[model samples]
Target: MKVFEPVVRLMNRLKYAQKFIVIAVVFVLVIASVSFILMQRMNSEITEMEQRYEGASYNTALKDVLQQVQIHRGTSVQAWNGSEDAQSKLASIREQANRALHVLNEQHTKQTYPLHIDEELDAINEQWQAIAEKDRWQDRDELTTLHTNLTTFIIETMLTVSNESSLQLARSPASQNLIATLTKTMPSVTENAGNLRWLGASVLAKEGDMTAQERAHISEKFYLMIEEFATIDADLQRAFTDPDIQAAVQSTYEEATAANELYATMVEQLLNGETANLTSAAFFEAATNTINLQFDLYSTSLAHLTTLMEQQLSELKMNRIMLVLLETLIVLVAMYLFMGFYIGIKRSITTIEQAAISIAEGDLTTSIHLHTKDEMLEIEHAFNKMTTGLQSLVKEIGESSQYVTASSEELHVGVEETTKSIMHVAEMMSDVSEGANEQTARLQQSEDALQHMTNDVAQIVTNSEDVAQLALTTMTLAHDGNDVMQQSSTQMNTIQQSVETTQHMIEALHGRSEQITHILQLITGVAEQTNLLSLNASIEAARAGEYGKGFAVVANEVGKLAAEARNAAHEVGTLVQGIQKDTTTSVQLMGDVTTQVRTGMDLSTTTAQKFEQIVSSMEQLSEQINGIIVNSSQVASSTEQVVTAIDAMKVISTKNMAASTEVATATEQQNASMEEMAASATELATMSETLQTLIQRFKV
Candidate 1:
């Protein structure tokens, strides 16, 4: 992570386009650089192997020339020494050698060789041509010398070609040394072994005691052949040490050495002055066998070397192919990772941009979401927190605002209803006042009628004057007082009935308040449901993505508004409960006022019953006018009690007035309280509207 910190910082500073460009440039540079190095190496390897392979063909051409020339050497020696079979074979063998020379010449013409090897090849070919052109037999030793010299040139050319073409070189030590043995060491051994064959056959053909110079030549060739075999053996030993060397190389080499040892034993006869047992042909045959086996070793080694080079060339080609593919894969993978990272970063940035824009537009309900597991996830979380808090605060403010508006309206309506009730109660109080005054006047009339009755009774008792007229007057006044008292009772009863009806109406209003409160609760529940539905819509729209982005935003705003509405409904429900409580209190107060009205009605009824008794007493007084004259003092006492009853009625009427005044005062206070509540509600409503105006700025 720390290793990538610089890249991270650079990437953070760069825009997405700049980052993409940087990554693309770096990717191309790295891949191109690595590919160039590997391709150069592979090309060099392929070229070297191809050259070596091409040189193998030249070497084979040289080997063909060497083969015929080696045979040519032996036949020339035999023919010069007077072997009829050798003389017969000599011309055809020369032709074969010449044909091989022609083929090698053709090969040389097609491709240029190294200056040294090419010159050596031309000289070798010219010497072979000169030898083939000489048809007449020369001295045996001279002819052998010509053939030996030409064959030596051919072998040398082969070695030069091997060296020039890098056939003697290989990748590993064992293989390198092995190829050296085949191309350089084994070729020399085979040629020297051919030398022994010819020299020894010449000695056998002479059939005389070997001359000192000839014997010396035979001794040197035999030992040189032995020494070269030793060198080849050592080289082969080294080659076999490699684990990968063929087991057949060791087996074939052992067979060649066996043949060489046999030939060495035969050559000992020519060296030790025992030429009787060995004929020229037998000596030649034995020596040729040794050369052939040595040639077999050369051939096997060459094949192995060629195979090794081919495998090396194949491996190099495969490596080049693999390197190309690997480079391609590296490029593809690098591009994939960079593009994925780029796309991921781009997507994250887009998301952040959208969320920020939404917030800028006052859409607090828009929450940030990210799918990638990166630093952007932290940013998304932070954004979500910010939006969620803002949304909650706005929702609370809106809810409070709507609650205030509703409460204000409810308060205003309550004030109006309460003011009307106060006015109705005031009208009822005015009626009670008039009824009280009417009752007071009636009481005064009864007092005057009693005064007249007393005067009439005094006249009847003192002067025995008009007893029947006084009795009739007393009865008529009693009837009139009874009727007035009944009228007063009827008015009082009407007041009591009005109070009971007002109480019942107030109670009914309380019941209606309770029902209204229940309906408000239902509306509050509906608001909550609306909030829930908005939330569900928002969820669905979020799931819908591109198709529903606008819908999701709308739903989110709706959900917030619904939350506000639900809260407002709850607050209004609370206000309605308060109103309900007030209504219940008003009903209770009306009950109390109704009870007072009933008490006043009972007092009026008692006064009416007293008048009825006074009327009955008047009826009995007609029969007893004398008795009426004597009980006139009792009547005056009864009139005094009646006046005391009227005073009590006046006191009841005063209390009713005072009670009515208290009721009016209380209603006024309630009205004023409602008025204050309405003012507060209006102010709250204004604040609600202000909050709503601000909230509307946010789309969600």
Candidate 2:
């Protein structure tokens, strides 16, 4: 199972030259890809948004300009006074209308529509300007036709260029609401425009000087037309409230009605012979103000629509930018965690795995050579300690073997000597028996006269009785002496047999000691080998210089232990030699005693039958004494074995202590190295944090 930990570690340990380059390349590729896609989307959105905003702006501007032109045109037509200033006013109206037409053209072009409607509107505006420039009011019919034509142009050009029919269909619910607003406001505009046109027509019809009767007739006719216009104003007012036409139609009618009423009043006065001197300047001024009032309504409506459009645009832009920034921040945060924090964890895991594998292979020296001070380093330190312990245990076993071998040799020699001594003692008993026999023979010859005396006294009474008692006393003393000699021979033979049993026990103990010695030797050899290994490790540590000083000390300690083991071996050898010498001397003495005992035993057996009662008692005593001797021999053998085993154990324990010390030293060294690595890793992590912070400064 290839988990991320090991893989990440391997990846991190890869040459920094390659690692950094890869990181840089990857970062660049990722950032470039993200930035490119984001930029493209943003650009497309910006383009769409810009088009909507600009379209709304142009439409609003066009509406305002058109309203201004309509107002001025109405004012010029409304002039009731017969003043030349009417011509100048009409010229100004034409100029304003032309400007409105130009704005409409620009709006259409910006919207990417055909230029057809704009061209037609421009022509209409030119026609109105041409009509205004002509000064021929004397032909009343012509002047009225000119006003009629101008009204046609306003209606036709506006409807054609603005495409009001299509605009009504295109209107959203909000746009429809704006259109409905015209119901309340356009009536006044219509009334004012209508009144102005009526007044101008009446003034034209009544032009030129005339006799009283002629003037009255012409004036009355003009009055009748003016009255008609006044009625039209009332109709216009009704129309303003009409569900269909509303304010636009109503205002046109009202303008005509007002202009007409003024014209009728002037005509009536003139016809009735009352000279009411009306001037063109005053009429124009009143008409202009009325038109301006109408324009103000349209301007206010346009302003409301513009404000709505601008507000919507502003909100849309603000929300879009905020959303973009918020999403970007979230994305950037995720990226930071993935690349910085998560990556750091992965690197640490990799380093820990590497250290673990190294340690698992009997390499107590395996260290999480990481600069990181995290949990991984702690684990490495623990591993190092475990390995050190193993090394030490192995080293101690080697140091204690020599003593066990020496003790075994000593036991063997002791056993052989004791067996020989038993045989010698048995032979010595035979020699003692022969000496007793010779003494007994001499006593037999000396007792012959006493025996003869005792026989003579047996017949002779009191004197003879004294002689027999003396012979009896001498024979009792001789028999008691023979019994003492036999007892001495049997005791010597028993002692020799006991020595032989001791020798057999010693031999068994020797075998056990040899086994122990062999084991000790193995342990000592292992310890020596371990010491050498430690020394080599120390050398390596020393080569590491300042960093390895602690390790070097541990190595020195191990080397010292090796030397100590050698000294111990020498001492054990000497002790063994002494034991061997003592056992050899004991074996020789035992051998001589065993031979004598055997000879004595043979001699005693021959005499044993001659003195059955005494031999039986002596044999019982010898059997009891032999058991005592065997038990004593066993005790001595056991003691020697115990001593030897203890010496072996002492040597082993000393070696173990030394090994433990070495282990502790190695552990300490490993800990030191791990600590350094941990510190370095910690610093590296800190630096990475700083680097990440610095990297974030670039606007993505």
TM-score of each: 0.56, 0.36
What is the C-alpha lDDT profile of model 1 across 1-700, one tens digit per residue?
8999998999999889898988799879977987898798789878778677667777767777777788888877777777899889988887887787788878777764442566787688778778888877557666767877877777777777777777666778888778777677666776777777777887777784577887788788778888888888888888888866757587788888899888988888678877778888998998888887777777777767777778888999999899889889988898898888888888888987787676656676787678868888887776676566556645654564566457546645754565566457556655655665665576567656656655665666665567666667767877887787788678777767766665565555456446545545654564565466557656655543454465466557656655665565566556556655655665666566566657656766776776677677778777766676667667666666666666666666566555555545554554454455445445545544654676677654
Clash totals, every prediction: 0, 67
Could you list the CA RMSD of all candidates, in the order they appear? 12.6, 21.1
Model 1: CA > 4 A from native: 1-14, 102-116, 137-142, 389-695
Per-residue lDDT value at 687 in model 1 = 47
| Cα lDDT listed for each candidate | 0.70, 0.45
